[model samples]
Target: MSEQIETWGDLVERAGVGIGGTPSDAPVTKLISAPIPITGSDGTKDFGGCGSGCGCMPQA
Candidate 1:
């Protein structure tokens, strides 16, 4: 009486293993187009620079 679900369709078909009767609302996530803009000097900053010390701008 044990089963393993491997796909979305299988998940929707199974009952009792989950809420047993109905689907519940899932949380939502909103992504940003770009990294949030940093304002002025945030005091501490990430100086993560290209490991290349060739003095040229790294190809982001």
Candidate 2:
């Protein structure tokens, strides 16, 4: 039998999905606020690691 999941709750209810193993009360904000320094002066200082021109950055 095949089933479609439309929401996070639906996916969590399914078995073998490892939903119960995850902590429900985990902190919402676990991201590190520190800026990662990029070494090597290859004239790549303008390339913002994970922002702007970088593909890792979130697009507005």
Candidate 3:
């Protein structure tokens, strides 16, 4: 089962795409959503960052 699962590094290495420290080379828009600040009823402010994950393309 482990073999069936491919990680981001594996895919990038297989595709020969250099994984730079930045997301400039990404084919897809890495920005899933803009930073959103939410205010609760208690007057507390919360900021949400990008969703968690490697943001890599799925294997075909």
What local distance difference test score does each model get?
0.41, 0.47, 0.44
Give lDDT tens digits, candidate 3, residues 20-57: 67444334323454233344446655423234442332
Residue-level lDDT tens digits of model 2 in 1-60:
346555444555554465565554433332343344443257664544555655344334
Estimated TM-score for each candidate:
0.21, 0.23, 0.25
Candidate number with greatest TM-score: 3
Candidate 1 local distance difference test against the native: 0.41
Model 1, stretches more than 4 Å misplaced?
16-60
Cα lDDT for residue 43, candidate 3: 65
TM-score of 3: 0.25
* lDDT tens digits by residue: candidate 1, 27-47: 223333334332234544453
| lDDT winner, 1 or 2 | 2
